[model samples]
Target: MGGDHTISYPILQAISGFRVVGAEECWHKSLTPLMKEVREQMGDGPVYISFDIDAIDPGFCPGTGTPEMGGLTPIQALEIVRGCRGLNIVGCDVVEVSPPYDFEGTTALQGAHLLFEMLCVLPGVQYSR
Candidate 1:
């Protein structure tokens, strides 16, 4: 057994060299350009996008504890997801959802629905074991 090593684990200690490579300003810009860069860098390989719902504002998605204001709207998120339409999707996981934070279940519903929307885009997705 390993202790939070590799892509399978979340701690990401060995990933010290890993950079938080995108600019916050860029996220507000058109996603197509960034997606193109990602595609070019990936070079005809598989890509997995984890569309975390918490990336949206807490006003609209109030279940997450760390909800950032002025985040992407659902439509914007969908557009970004659709932009990755032709890429080979290996897998993805949307996380950081604290359903308990949303007393009325609003955030949980949005998170689940977003996951469903992602599934709609990924037809051959392997259900996690």
Candidate 2:
């Protein structure tokens, strides 16, 4: 689960089009509404989530191959992943973590946590709530 931003091209080839909710959008909009757009486009179809590590600020995730100055917060990351709770998430991944760059392993840890969050949002995972 270490996808790079460039990986999107291949993924896009499989679909007709997509909506870009990059760092700029996440800064102003709620992921809930963003997820709604996804739901509207996907229409109960099987979905795959590919999260790139560099999407988060380098301060919080500097171990990635490309570190960006301003990015989503770890909390916002959870919001994004959690936003998929009701979708038919066929598969998901978090990529772009370069271990050598993050000596303390925080980036790796963020990747791991993102993976865990992805798992939690998959269909058929019953919650006690």
Candidate 3:
């Protein structure tokens, strides 16, 4: 978690005029603690959540390079994203999807579906190609 935030800090710092703080492990049992800390440190800025489905439990989404056990469910993940309502979501991406690893196509399918769900939660403003 710290590594991810460390890598993301510089880019966010460049785009926004504030320093990015807090390193929350998305797969942790309680997401609220991490989220609260981020909110406290960052203070309600536009938040773009990059969800790597691999972070979810393999049973829930068995398609990714590294599948962790006991990760959040799809619904839980979606809720986390939705919970950040009212914050500006500039953009998002769900990466690390190696289709070869997903024998049943469940992972890729869910990945695409979740992308649509995320779009729905985004600002109503239209996007151009």
Candidate 4:
């Protein structure tokens, strides 16, 4: 539930099981509160992060298939990931990065950066670089 303004019907149907927090909702509220709700829902279980590059604004990440405007900035994205700190993150992934559409590889770099951010929030992972 990141930056999907024009979500298709099929995709909507597919994500019915997820608790979607829309882009507007994210903009209007702080991520900490939303993440608190998520934590309550998740209850003490291991978490998995599936980060879509398209969640970021095209201005920051132009390599995704469906680049949407008014999306999260890189800093905002990192903060959202950071909000997962103290959770039991067992695994994570970053997806929907199209290198062919990237400008000077900025999007790919951002994807990597996001991955790093996720790793930083994991329970016991130690990263340096």
Estimate the TM-score of every prediction. 0.65, 0.82, 0.65, 0.77
Report the alpha-carbon TM-score of model 4 versus the true structure.
0.77
- Which of candidates 1 and 4 reaches a greater TM-score? 4
Q: Model 3: per-residue lDDT, tens digit, 74-114?
A: 76666656554545667666766677888998888777876
Please provide, for model 4 over 1-129, each residue's C-alpha lDDT reduced to its tens digit, 9 standing for 90 to 100: 333334344343333234877887777446777777777776666576778889888988999888999888787787778877877666667888887899689998998888878879888766654
The alpha-carbon lDDT assigned to residue 106 of candidate 4 equals 93
Better of 2 and 4 by lDDT: 2
Question: Which candidate comes out best when scored by lDDT?
Answer: 2
Q: Which stretches of candidate 2 lie over 4 Å from their true place?
A: 3-17
Superior candidate under lDDT, 1 versus 4: 4
Off by over 4 Å in 3: 1-44, 125-129
Report the C-alpha lDDT of model 2 over 1-129, residue by residue, as the tens digit: 665656564455445345776587688556777776777787776677888898899999999877898798888888888888887677777888998899898999999989988888889886543
User: Which ten contiguous residues of candidate 1 have the minimum total lDDT?
Assistant: 10-19
Per-residue lDDT tens digits for candidate 1, residues 1-129, read: 101113443333212221244336545566667666655665545566565666777778777767787787666666666665556556555676675787887767776766666676564654442
Worst 10 residues of 2 by lDDT: 9-18
Candidate closest to the true structure, highest TM-score: 2
Give Cα-based local distance difference scores for all models.
Answer: 0.59, 0.79, 0.62, 0.75
Q: Model 2, residue 65: displacement in angstroms? A: 1.1
